[model samples]
Target: MKNLIFSLPFFLTLFFGTHVNAQKISDGQTIEINGMSVTFNILNKESVEAGGKPYDRYKVSATVKNASDKGYNIRLSSYPQIVSNIGLVELNCINATGAKLTSKKIELKMKAQMINVSYSAYDKSGKFTTNMIPITGSYYFDPGDTISDNAIFIVPQGEKPDVSVRNLR
Candidate 1:
Protein backbone atom coordinates (compact mmCIF):
# COMPACT_ATOMS: atom_id res chain seq x y z
CA MET A 1 0.00 0.00 0.00
CA LYS A 2 2.80 2.37 0.83
CA ASN A 3 4.56 1.64 -2.44
CA LEU A 4 1.35 2.15 -4.36
CA ILE A 5 0.79 5.45 -2.69
CA PHE A 6 4.25 6.62 -3.60
CA SER A 7 4.08 5.44 -7.18
CA LEU A 8 0.54 6.70 -7.68
CA PRO A 9 1.66 10.29 -7.46
CA PHE A 10 4.47 9.63 -9.87
CA PHE A 11 2.18 7.99 -12.39
CA LEU A 12 -0.42 10.70 -11.97
CA THR A 13 2.17 13.38 -12.46
CA LEU A 14 3.44 11.77 -15.64
CA PHE A 15 -0.07 11.28 -17.00
CA PHE A 16 -1.49 14.65 -16.12
CA GLY A 17 1.77 16.32 -16.95
CA THR A 18 1.45 15.10 -20.53
CA HIS A 19 -1.83 16.93 -20.93
CA VAL A 20 -0.82 20.06 -19.05
CA ASN A 21 2.13 20.68 -21.33
CA ALA A 22 0.94 19.48 -24.73
CA GLN A 23 1.24 22.42 -27.04
CA LYS A 24 -1.64 22.78 -29.47
CA ILE A 25 -0.33 22.24 -33.00
CA SER A 26 -2.67 23.68 -35.55
CA ASP A 27 -3.28 21.81 -38.81
CA GLY A 28 -1.14 22.91 -41.73
CA GLN A 29 1.21 25.00 -39.65
CA THR A 30 3.91 26.19 -42.00
CA ILE A 31 7.44 26.53 -40.75
CA GLU A 32 10.92 26.94 -42.24
CA ILE A 33 12.64 23.56 -42.20
CA ASN A 34 15.86 23.01 -44.08
CA GLY A 35 15.39 26.32 -45.88
CA MET A 36 12.07 25.10 -47.22
CA SER A 37 8.46 25.97 -46.44
CA VAL A 38 7.46 22.96 -44.44
CA THR A 39 3.89 22.40 -43.23
CA PHE A 40 3.24 19.92 -40.43
CA ASN A 41 0.27 18.38 -38.63
CA ILE A 42 0.40 16.28 -35.49
CA LEU A 43 -2.04 13.44 -34.76
CA ASN A 44 -2.64 11.36 -31.64
CA LYS A 45 -3.53 7.78 -32.39
CA GLU A 46 -3.98 4.41 -30.72
CA SER A 47 -2.50 2.76 -33.80
CA VAL A 48 -1.24 3.64 -37.27
CA GLU A 49 -1.87 1.81 -40.51
CA ALA A 50 0.98 1.04 -42.85
CA GLY A 51 1.66 -1.22 -45.84
CA GLY A 52 -2.01 -2.20 -46.08
CA LYS A 53 -1.88 -3.56 -42.54
CA PRO A 54 -2.37 -2.32 -38.98
CA TYR A 55 -0.90 -2.91 -35.54
CA ASP A 56 -1.31 -1.84 -31.92
CA ARG A 57 0.80 1.13 -30.86
CA TYR A 58 0.80 4.37 -28.87
CA LYS A 59 2.47 7.42 -30.44
CA VAL A 60 1.97 10.72 -32.22
CA SER A 61 2.25 11.27 -35.97
CA ALA A 62 3.68 14.40 -37.51
CA THR A 63 2.32 14.64 -41.07
CA VAL A 64 4.98 16.71 -42.79
CA LYS A 65 4.75 18.60 -46.09
CA ASN A 66 7.75 19.89 -47.93
CA ALA A 67 6.39 22.98 -49.58
CA SER A 68 9.68 23.98 -51.11
CA ASP A 69 11.00 24.04 -54.65
CA LYS A 70 13.87 21.72 -53.79
CA GLY A 71 14.63 18.36 -52.30
CA TYR A 72 15.86 17.47 -48.76
CA ASN A 73 17.21 14.41 -47.05
CA ILE A 74 16.26 13.20 -43.55
CA ARG A 75 17.51 10.40 -41.40
CA LEU A 76 15.12 8.04 -39.56
CA SER A 77 15.98 5.58 -36.84
CA SER A 78 14.82 2.01 -36.46
CA TYR A 79 12.59 3.27 -33.65
CA PRO A 80 10.59 6.31 -32.68
CA GLN A 81 12.05 9.31 -30.91
CA ILE A 82 11.20 9.96 -27.26
CA VAL A 83 10.15 13.57 -27.19
CA SER A 84 9.60 15.35 -23.89
CA ASN A 85 9.29 18.96 -22.87
CA ILE A 86 13.07 19.25 -22.88
CA GLY A 87 13.33 18.01 -26.46
CA LEU A 88 13.76 14.87 -28.58
CA VAL A 89 16.04 12.31 -27.01
CA GLU A 90 18.53 10.80 -29.44
CA LEU A 91 16.98 7.61 -30.83
CA ASN A 92 19.35 6.92 -33.72
CA CYS A 93 18.46 3.47 -35.06
CA ILE A 94 21.68 2.87 -36.95
CA ASN A 95 23.46 -0.43 -36.55
CA ALA A 96 24.30 -3.38 -38.85
CA THR A 97 22.45 -5.75 -41.18
CA GLY A 98 19.07 -7.24 -40.16
CA ALA A 99 18.61 -4.10 -38.07
CA LYS A 100 15.57 -1.87 -38.54
CA LEU A 101 17.86 1.04 -39.33
CA THR A 102 19.86 -1.08 -41.69
CA SER A 103 18.12 0.65 -44.60
CA LYS A 104 17.76 4.07 -43.04
CA LYS A 105 17.22 6.02 -46.24
CA ILE A 106 14.14 8.14 -47.18
CA GLU A 107 13.98 9.77 -50.60
CA LEU A 108 11.48 12.50 -51.40
CA LYS A 109 10.79 13.71 -54.92
CA MET A 110 8.26 16.53 -54.73
CA LYS A 111 4.76 15.05 -55.04
CA ALA A 112 6.12 11.74 -56.22
CA GLN A 113 7.22 10.70 -52.77
CA MET A 114 4.05 11.95 -51.09
CA ILE A 115 2.48 8.55 -51.35
CA ASN A 116 1.37 7.06 -48.07
CA VAL A 117 4.37 5.80 -46.09
CA SER A 118 4.49 2.03 -45.68
CA TYR A 119 6.60 1.89 -42.50
CA SER A 120 5.54 0.08 -39.35
CA ALA A 121 4.70 1.92 -36.15
CA TYR A 122 6.65 1.52 -32.96
CA ASP A 123 6.67 2.75 -29.38
CA LYS A 124 8.59 5.78 -28.24
CA SER A 125 11.01 3.45 -26.52
CA GLY A 126 12.41 2.10 -29.82
CA LYS A 127 10.35 -1.09 -30.00
CA PHE A 128 8.94 -2.16 -33.35
CA THR A 129 5.34 -3.40 -33.52
CA THR A 130 5.64 -4.45 -37.16
CA ASN A 131 8.29 -5.39 -39.67
CA MET A 132 7.30 -3.03 -42.49
CA ILE A 133 9.87 -0.33 -41.81
CA PRO A 134 12.66 1.27 -43.82
CA ILE A 135 16.20 -0.02 -43.50
CA THR A 136 19.26 2.15 -44.18
CA GLY A 137 16.98 5.17 -44.22
CA SER A 138 17.85 8.48 -45.87
CA TYR A 139 14.88 10.70 -46.84
CA TYR A 140 14.98 12.96 -49.91
CA PHE A 141 12.31 15.64 -50.23
CA ASP A 142 11.54 17.72 -53.29
CA PRO A 143 9.49 20.85 -53.81
CA GLY A 144 5.67 20.98 -53.30
CA ASP A 145 5.35 17.58 -51.72
CA THR A 146 3.00 16.59 -48.89
CA ILE A 147 3.95 13.42 -47.11
CA SER A 148 2.13 12.09 -44.06
CA ASP A 149 4.78 10.01 -42.39
CA ASN A 150 4.61 8.96 -38.73
CA ALA A 151 8.34 8.55 -38.17
CA ILE A 152 9.02 11.12 -35.48
CA PHE A 153 8.46 12.15 -31.86
CA ILE A 154 6.50 15.40 -31.81
CA VAL A 155 5.56 15.23 -28.14
CA PRO A 156 6.03 18.67 -26.63
CA GLN A 157 5.90 17.14 -23.14
CA GLY A 158 5.66 20.52 -21.39
CA GLU A 159 7.90 22.68 -23.51
CA LYS A 160 8.02 23.92 -27.09
CA PRO A 161 9.46 21.67 -29.83
CA ASP A 162 13.17 22.34 -30.14
CA VAL A 163 13.99 19.92 -32.95
CA SER A 164 15.38 21.63 -36.00
CA VAL A 165 15.55 19.99 -39.46
CA ARG A 166 18.02 22.36 -41.05
CA ASN A 167 18.54 22.31 -44.82
CA LEU A 168 21.93 21.47 -46.25
CA ARG A 169 23.26 24.66 -47.73
Candidate 2:
Protein backbone atom coordinates (compact mmCIF):
# COMPACT_ATOMS: atom_id res chain seq x y z
CA MET A 1 0.00 0.00 0.00
CA LYS A 2 2.85 2.40 0.80
CA ASN A 3 4.74 1.66 -2.44
CA LEU A 4 1.62 1.94 -4.56
CA ILE A 5 0.58 5.14 -2.85
CA PHE A 6 4.08 6.69 -3.21
CA SER A 7 4.38 5.73 -6.92
CA LEU A 8 0.95 7.19 -7.79
CA PRO A 9 2.14 10.73 -7.13
CA PHE A 10 5.26 10.31 -9.30
CA PHE A 11 3.34 8.71 -12.16
CA LEU A 12 0.63 11.34 -12.07
CA THR A 13 3.20 14.10 -12.00
CA LEU A 14 5.09 12.67 -14.98
CA PHE A 15 1.99 12.31 -17.14
CA PHE A 16 0.27 15.54 -16.14
CA GLY A 17 3.45 17.63 -16.21
CA THR A 18 4.29 16.66 -19.79
CA HIS A 19 0.82 17.54 -21.03
CA VAL A 20 0.77 20.76 -19.09
CA ASN A 21 4.19 21.83 -20.36
CA ALA A 22 3.61 20.73 -23.92
CA GLN A 23 3.58 23.37 -26.64
CA LYS A 24 0.36 25.27 -26.91
CA ILE A 25 -1.30 24.54 -30.24
CA SER A 26 -3.02 27.51 -31.72
CA ASP A 27 -6.38 26.55 -33.23
CA GLY A 28 -5.20 22.95 -33.15
CA GLN A 29 -5.94 22.44 -36.83
CA THR A 30 -3.84 20.97 -39.63
CA ILE A 31 -4.30 20.25 -43.32
CA GLU A 32 -2.01 18.41 -45.74
CA ILE A 33 -1.36 19.19 -49.40
CA ASN A 34 1.20 17.71 -51.79
CA GLY A 35 2.82 15.90 -48.89
CA MET A 36 3.14 19.17 -47.04
CA SER A 37 1.72 19.90 -43.62
CA VAL A 38 -0.26 23.09 -43.11
CA THR A 39 -1.16 24.16 -39.62
CA PHE A 40 -3.77 26.87 -39.13
CA ASN A 41 -4.07 29.14 -36.14
CA ILE A 42 -6.01 32.25 -35.23
CA LEU A 43 -3.41 34.98 -35.13
CA ASN A 44 -3.07 37.39 -32.26
CA LYS A 45 -4.72 40.27 -34.04
CA GLU A 46 -4.13 43.88 -33.06
CA SER A 47 -6.02 47.14 -33.39
CA VAL A 48 -5.65 48.75 -36.80
CA GLU A 49 -5.35 52.47 -37.29
CA ALA A 50 -6.03 53.10 -40.96
CA GLY A 51 -7.46 56.11 -42.75
CA GLY A 52 -7.12 58.10 -39.52
CA LYS A 53 -9.40 55.59 -37.80
CA PRO A 54 -8.57 52.92 -35.25
CA TYR A 55 -10.40 49.60 -35.43
CA ASP A 56 -9.96 46.02 -34.26
CA ARG A 57 -9.28 43.38 -36.91
CA TYR A 58 -9.13 39.59 -37.13
CA LYS A 59 -6.35 37.64 -38.82
CA VAL A 60 -5.31 34.04 -39.29
CA SER A 61 -1.84 32.52 -39.59
CA ALA A 62 -0.91 29.51 -41.64
CA THR A 63 2.32 27.52 -41.22
CA VAL A 64 3.26 25.32 -44.15
CA LYS A 65 5.82 22.53 -43.94
CA ASN A 66 7.26 20.93 -47.06
CA ALA A 67 8.35 17.47 -45.97
CA SER A 68 9.00 15.97 -49.37
CA ASP A 69 12.54 15.85 -50.72
CA LYS A 70 11.59 17.14 -54.15
CA GLY A 71 11.12 20.87 -54.45
CA TYR A 72 7.57 21.86 -55.41
CA ASN A 73 6.66 25.30 -56.63
CA ILE A 74 3.77 26.53 -54.49
CA ARG A 75 2.04 29.88 -54.23
CA LEU A 76 0.28 30.90 -51.02
CA SER A 77 -1.41 34.03 -49.74
CA SER A 78 0.31 35.53 -46.76
CA TYR A 79 -3.16 36.69 -45.80
CA PRO A 80 -5.45 34.08 -47.24
CA GLN A 81 -9.04 34.73 -46.21
CA ILE A 82 -9.60 31.07 -45.66
CA VAL A 83 -6.83 28.53 -45.02
CA SER A 84 -8.56 25.43 -46.29
CA ASN A 85 -7.63 22.28 -48.25
CA ILE A 86 -10.43 22.57 -50.80
CA GLY A 87 -8.59 25.17 -52.88
CA LEU A 88 -11.20 27.68 -51.73
CA VAL A 89 -8.67 30.18 -50.45
CA GLU A 90 -9.63 33.87 -50.38
CA LEU A 91 -8.70 37.24 -48.91
CA ASN A 92 -11.22 39.13 -46.79
CA CYS A 93 -11.26 42.68 -48.16
CA ILE A 94 -13.86 44.47 -46.07
CA ASN A 95 -11.08 45.61 -43.70
CA ALA A 96 -7.94 44.11 -45.23
CA THR A 97 -4.76 46.06 -46.01
CA GLY A 98 -1.25 45.23 -47.12
CA ALA A 99 1.86 46.86 -48.51
CA LYS A 100 2.11 47.18 -52.31
CA LEU A 101 -1.63 46.53 -52.68
CA THR A 102 -3.17 47.83 -55.87
CA SER A 103 -5.75 50.55 -55.41
CA LYS A 104 -7.97 49.04 -58.13
CA LYS A 105 -8.03 45.43 -56.97
CA ILE A 106 -6.50 42.77 -54.66
CA GLU A 107 -5.94 39.50 -56.53
CA LEU A 108 -5.56 36.30 -54.49
CA LYS A 109 -3.26 34.50 -56.96
CA MET A 110 -3.89 31.02 -55.47
CA LYS A 111 -2.36 29.25 -58.49
CA ALA A 112 -1.53 26.12 -56.62
CA GLN A 113 -4.48 23.80 -57.02
CA MET A 114 -5.22 22.03 -60.33
CA ILE A 115 -8.51 23.80 -60.78
CA ASN A 116 -8.86 27.36 -61.98
CA VAL A 117 -10.21 28.86 -58.73
CA SER A 118 -9.50 32.52 -59.34
CA TYR A 119 -11.92 34.85 -57.56
CA SER A 120 -12.48 37.27 -54.62
CA ALA A 121 -14.96 38.16 -51.89
CA TYR A 122 -15.77 40.33 -48.89
CA ASP A 123 -15.72 39.72 -45.12
CA LYS A 124 -18.07 41.71 -42.94
CA SER A 125 -19.39 39.52 -40.17
CA GLY A 126 -18.23 37.17 -37.43
CA LYS A 127 -19.63 34.20 -39.39
CA PHE A 128 -18.61 32.58 -42.71
CA THR A 129 -19.99 34.91 -45.35
CA THR A 130 -17.61 34.76 -48.33
CA ASN A 131 -17.43 37.22 -51.20
CA MET A 132 -15.54 37.47 -54.46
CA ILE A 133 -13.27 40.43 -53.85
CA PRO A 134 -10.13 41.00 -55.92
CA ILE A 135 -6.71 41.24 -54.31
CA THR A 136 -3.08 42.04 -55.12
CA GLY A 137 0.41 40.59 -54.48
CA SER A 138 2.39 37.51 -55.51
CA TYR A 139 3.75 34.95 -53.04
CA TYR A 140 4.90 31.35 -53.46
CA PHE A 141 6.44 28.50 -51.45
CA ASP A 142 8.98 25.74 -52.02
CA PRO A 143 9.95 22.31 -50.74
CA GLY A 144 11.55 21.57 -47.34
CA ASP A 145 10.26 24.86 -46.10
CA THR A 146 7.97 26.10 -43.33
CA ILE A 147 6.32 29.50 -43.65
CA SER A 148 3.53 31.38 -41.90
CA ASP A 149 1.43 34.45 -42.71
CA ASN A 150 -1.59 36.39 -41.42
CA ALA A 151 -4.79 37.57 -43.16
CA ILE A 152 -6.72 40.54 -41.85
CA PHE A 153 -10.53 40.64 -41.70
CA ILE A 154 -13.30 42.88 -40.50
CA VAL A 155 -16.15 42.04 -38.16
CA PRO A 156 -18.67 44.80 -38.30
CA GLN A 157 -20.05 46.04 -35.02
CA GLY A 158 -23.23 43.89 -35.10
CA GLU A 159 -23.28 41.66 -38.19
CA LYS A 160 -22.89 37.88 -37.85
CA PRO A 161 -20.67 37.15 -40.87
CA ASP A 162 -20.26 33.71 -42.32
CA VAL A 163 -16.94 32.05 -41.59
CA SER A 164 -17.08 29.68 -44.55
CA VAL A 165 -15.53 30.55 -47.89
CA ARG A 166 -18.18 31.26 -50.50
CA ASN A 167 -18.30 30.75 -54.25
CA LEU A 168 -19.48 34.29 -54.82
CA ARG A 169 -18.10 34.30 -58.33
Candidate 3:
Protein backbone atom coordinates (compact mmCIF):
# COMPACT_ATOMS: atom_id res chain seq x y z
CA MET A 1 0.00 0.00 0.00
CA LYS A 2 2.80 2.41 0.81
CA ASN A 3 4.58 1.68 -2.48
CA LEU A 4 1.39 2.28 -4.41
CA ILE A 5 0.80 5.59 -2.68
CA PHE A 6 4.31 6.83 -3.39
CA SER A 7 4.22 5.70 -7.01
CA LEU A 8 0.94 7.50 -7.58
CA PRO A 9 2.48 10.90 -6.89
CA PHE A 10 5.48 10.12 -9.06
CA PHE A 11 3.33 9.07 -11.96
CA LEU A 12 1.20 12.15 -11.65
CA THR A 13 4.22 14.41 -11.62
CA LEU A 14 5.74 12.74 -14.66
CA PHE A 15 2.54 13.10 -16.62
CA PHE A 16 1.87 16.74 -15.75
CA GLY A 17 5.45 17.90 -16.02
CA THR A 18 5.78 16.73 -19.61
CA HIS A 19 2.50 18.36 -20.50
CA VAL A 20 3.60 21.73 -19.18
CA ASN A 21 6.95 21.59 -20.93
CA ALA A 22 5.60 20.72 -24.39
CA GLN A 23 6.09 24.07 -26.09
CA LYS A 24 5.22 23.10 -29.66
CA ILE A 25 2.45 25.33 -30.92
CA SER A 26 0.36 24.93 -34.05
CA ASP A 27 -1.26 27.36 -36.49
CA GLY A 28 -3.69 29.98 -35.12
CA GLN A 29 -3.25 28.67 -31.58
CA THR A 30 -2.62 31.00 -28.68
CA ILE A 31 -0.61 30.33 -25.56
CA GLU A 32 -0.16 32.51 -22.51
CA ILE A 33 3.19 32.83 -20.82
CA ASN A 34 4.39 35.29 -18.19
CA GLY A 35 1.28 37.45 -18.50
CA MET A 36 1.72 37.70 -22.27
CA SER A 37 -0.53 36.15 -24.87
CA VAL A 38 1.16 34.86 -28.04
CA THR A 39 -0.30 33.38 -31.20
CA PHE A 40 1.58 31.68 -34.05
CA ASN A 41 0.40 30.68 -37.49
CA ILE A 42 1.47 30.08 -41.08
CA LEU A 43 -0.09 32.67 -43.30
CA ASN A 44 0.77 31.48 -46.81
CA LYS A 45 3.29 29.87 -49.13
CA GLU A 46 4.64 31.20 -52.40
CA SER A 47 7.55 31.10 -54.80
CA VAL A 48 10.01 33.94 -55.03
CA GLU A 49 13.34 34.89 -56.48
CA ALA A 50 16.10 36.03 -54.17
CA GLY A 51 19.50 37.08 -55.39
CA GLY A 52 18.80 35.55 -58.83
CA LYS A 53 17.91 32.20 -57.25
CA PRO A 54 14.42 30.75 -57.15
CA TYR A 55 13.05 29.21 -53.95
CA ASP A 56 9.89 28.51 -52.03
CA ARG A 57 8.96 30.93 -49.25
CA TYR A 58 6.59 30.42 -46.38
CA LYS A 59 5.12 33.32 -44.48
CA VAL A 60 4.71 32.68 -40.76
CA SER A 61 3.12 35.20 -38.44
CA ALA A 62 3.19 35.79 -34.72
CA THR A 63 1.04 38.07 -32.61
CA VAL A 64 1.97 39.09 -29.09
CA LYS A 65 -0.09 41.07 -26.62
CA ASN A 66 0.73 42.42 -23.20
CA ALA A 67 -1.95 41.02 -20.96
CA SER A 68 -0.54 42.31 -17.72
CA ASP A 69 -1.49 45.65 -16.27
CA LYS A 70 2.09 46.83 -16.06
CA GLY A 71 4.37 47.35 -19.02
CA TYR A 72 7.34 45.07 -19.60
CA ASN A 73 9.99 44.22 -22.18
CA ILE A 74 9.71 41.01 -24.16
CA ARG A 75 11.78 39.11 -26.73
CA LEU A 76 11.69 35.69 -28.33
CA SER A 77 14.48 33.38 -27.36
CA SER A 78 14.41 31.77 -30.82
CA TYR A 79 12.51 32.14 -34.04
CA PRO A 80 10.07 29.61 -35.47
CA GLN A 81 11.62 26.67 -37.29
CA ILE A 82 10.74 24.35 -40.14
CA VAL A 83 10.26 20.74 -39.16
CA SER A 84 10.44 17.93 -41.68
CA ASN A 85 10.54 14.15 -41.59
CA ILE A 86 14.30 14.29 -41.26
CA GLY A 87 14.57 16.77 -38.37
CA LEU A 88 14.24 20.36 -37.27
CA VAL A 89 15.80 22.71 -39.82
CA GLU A 90 17.14 26.08 -38.72
CA LEU A 91 17.79 29.32 -40.52
CA ASN A 92 21.15 29.07 -42.22
CA CYS A 93 22.96 30.18 -45.36
CA ILE A 94 24.42 26.89 -46.52
CA ASN A 95 22.42 24.48 -48.61
CA ALA A 96 22.30 20.82 -47.59
CA THR A 97 20.97 17.61 -49.12
CA GLY A 98 18.46 14.90 -48.10
CA ALA A 99 15.02 16.48 -48.38
CA LYS A 100 15.97 19.57 -46.39
CA LEU A 101 16.97 23.10 -47.42
CA THR A 102 18.90 25.84 -45.71
CA SER A 103 17.46 29.20 -44.66
CA LYS A 104 19.20 32.53 -44.50
CA LYS A 105 19.90 34.30 -41.23
CA ILE A 106 19.94 38.06 -41.44
CA GLU A 107 22.28 40.15 -39.33
CA LEU A 108 21.26 43.78 -39.00
CA LYS A 109 22.96 46.80 -37.55
CA MET A 110 20.85 48.61 -35.00
CA LYS A 111 20.72 52.34 -35.57
CA ALA A 112 21.43 54.59 -32.59
CA GLN A 113 18.23 56.58 -32.97
CA MET A 114 15.92 53.57 -33.22
CA ILE A 115 13.61 52.51 -30.43
CA ASN A 116 10.74 49.98 -30.32
CA VAL A 117 11.97 48.12 -33.39
CA SER A 118 10.40 45.29 -35.40
CA TYR A 119 11.68 43.15 -38.32
CA SER A 120 10.35 42.17 -41.73
CA ALA A 121 11.57 40.25 -44.80
CA TYR A 122 9.99 42.38 -47.49
CA ASP A 123 12.65 44.67 -48.94
CA LYS A 124 12.34 46.77 -52.04
CA SER A 125 15.79 45.75 -53.13
CA GLY A 126 14.66 42.10 -53.70
CA LYS A 127 17.10 40.66 -51.27
CA PHE A 128 15.90 37.63 -49.27
CA THR A 129 15.32 38.43 -45.61
CA THR A 130 13.06 37.30 -42.85
CA ASN A 131 10.84 39.78 -41.03
CA MET A 132 10.87 37.97 -37.76
CA ILE A 133 10.16 38.99 -34.20
CA PRO A 134 13.09 40.88 -32.76
CA ILE A 135 15.32 38.27 -31.26
CA THR A 136 18.26 40.67 -31.03
CA GLY A 137 16.79 42.91 -28.33
CA SER A 138 13.81 43.27 -26.08
CA TYR A 139 10.93 45.54 -27.07
CA TYR A 140 8.92 47.42 -24.51
CA PHE A 141 5.18 46.84 -24.52
CA ASP A 142 2.61 48.97 -22.79
CA PRO A 143 -0.35 47.43 -21.07
CA GLY A 144 -2.89 46.03 -23.52
CA ASP A 145 -0.59 46.76 -26.44
CA THR A 146 -0.20 44.18 -29.15
CA ILE A 147 2.39 43.63 -31.88
CA SER A 148 2.22 41.43 -34.94
CA ASP A 149 5.11 40.34 -37.14
CA ASN A 150 5.83 37.99 -40.02
CA ALA A 151 8.78 35.75 -40.79
CA ILE A 152 9.72 34.51 -44.25
CA PHE A 153 11.30 31.07 -44.53
CA ILE A 154 12.99 30.14 -47.78
CA VAL A 155 13.16 26.47 -48.61
CA PRO A 156 14.46 24.53 -51.56
CA GLN A 157 12.36 24.08 -54.62
CA GLY A 158 9.26 21.84 -54.20
CA GLU A 159 9.79 21.35 -50.47
CA LYS A 160 7.02 22.21 -48.04
CA PRO A 161 7.72 21.70 -44.37
CA ASP A 162 5.64 22.18 -41.26
CA VAL A 163 6.42 25.14 -39.02
CA SER A 164 6.75 24.96 -35.26
CA VAL A 165 7.32 27.65 -32.66
CA ARG A 166 9.12 26.50 -29.55
CA ASN A 167 10.59 28.17 -26.45
CA LEU A 168 8.65 31.29 -27.28
CA ARG A 169 8.13 32.33 -23.70
Q: What is the C-alpha RMSD of each candidate to the true structure, in Å?
A: 17.9, 18.0, 15.5
Query: Where does candidate 3 clash, by residue pair?
Result: 92-103, 120-131, 121-131
What's the TM for model 1? 0.28
Give the runs in model 1 whose Cα sits over 4 Å from its true position: 1-28, 45-58, 71-140, 151-164
Task: Give per-residue CA lDDT, model 2, range 82-142, as digits (tens).
Answer: 4333231232343333422312111222234433345444456655554454453333345
Model 3, span 99-123: residue lDDT tens:
2243332111111112344565758
In order, candidate lDDTs are: 0.38, 0.44, 0.52
lDDT of 2: 0.44
Which of the numbered candidates is closest to the native, going by highest lDDT? 3
TM-score of each: 0.28, 0.33, 0.41
Candidate 2: Cα lDDT at 98: 40
Candidate 2: list runs displaced more than 4 Å. 1-26, 45-56, 73-142, 156-169
Which has the higher lDDT value, candidate number 2 or candidate number 3? 3
After TM-score superposition, what is the CA distance of residue 39 in candidate 3 from its true location, in Å? 1.1
Kindly give the stretch of ten consecutive residues in candidate 3 with the minimal lDDT sum: 105-114
Q: Write the per-residue lDDT of candidate 1 for residues 1-169, one digit (tens) a residue.
A: 9999999989999877644433333344655545445334434434334444443222323334555566554554543543122111111112211122222211222221122346567778989865443333444555665554444332212322332232223
